[model samples]
Target: MLKELDPLLHSQLRLGVMSLLMGAESAEFTFLKEKTNATAGNLSVQLDKLSEAGYITIEKTFRGKKPLTRCRITRKGIKAFEEYVQALKGYIK
Candidate 1:
């Protein structure tokens, strides 16, 4: 039997975000938006999903007076992404 895939990691935006975060310490909201080519609203929604899944950590703070959002992938996210890739490889073979 095939292994079950993580639904959260399968999402395009969420996957992109995790892939990027996997490489960096953390990323700003604008950087993620540009990299993913996602709309602000869409990205925000997807981010909430990732956060709720405990796959990523979101830090909200004030940069002077404006709000700043930063994202970092959790250990669980890395493991999930790796497993997702392995599951996909099984299908390709």
Candidate 2:
């Protein structure tokens, strides 16, 4: 069933993350956490899933000795999101 939709872009949090990332060049972990209203642990898990699926990239860096996590959606992710929207529209009528 998910295949009919976009397999890579169906989960709620994942979709939310991708949607936000798609609109920006990149976004910070805290920004996505706030926007998705997800706990850090949950967000981290979801991010790992996306990264493993090759749908998004996660970069960890340091800012003044503090660790920072940033995210960006891959081109494959963009295509998946587009397809997911199209699939949803198919049922809208």
Candidate 3:
């Protein structure tokens, strides 16, 4: 039987976010938006869901005069992503 996929990370945008976060220390909101080709409002909402799940951390601060938002995957997120990959493998084979 195929393993169940994580509903949260299963989202294309969220999955893209996690996939990108795995490669770097942290990512700025604009960078994720650009990479995922997501709208600002949509990305913000998805980020909130991940944050609520404790899978990622969101830091909001000011960079000079502008608001700066950065996201970093947590240990929980790494484990979740890894498991998600493993589960996907089960289906592929």
The global C-alpha lDDT for each of the candidates, from Candidate 1 onward, is: 0.92, 0.88, 0.97
The collision pairs in model 1 are none
- TM for every model, in the order presented, reads 0.93, 0.91, 0.98
Residue 57 in model 3: lDDT:
99
Q: Give the per-residue lDDT of model 1 (tens digit) for 23-93.
A: 99999999999999999999999999999988899999999999999999898888888999999888787
Per-residue lDDT of model 3, residues 1-93, tens digit only: 899999999989999999999999999999999999999999999999999999999999999999999999999999999999999999889
lDDT of 3 at 48: 97
Misplaced by over 4 Å in model 1 are: none
* Alpha carbon lDDT at 68, candidate 1: 97
Badly placed stretches (over 4 Å) of model 2 are 1-3
Q: Whole-model lDDT for model 2 versus the true structure?
A: 0.88
What are the per-model numbers of colliding residue pairs?
A: 0, 0, 0
* Candidate order (lDDT): 3, 1, 2
lDDT of 3: 0.97
lDDT of 2 at 54: 83
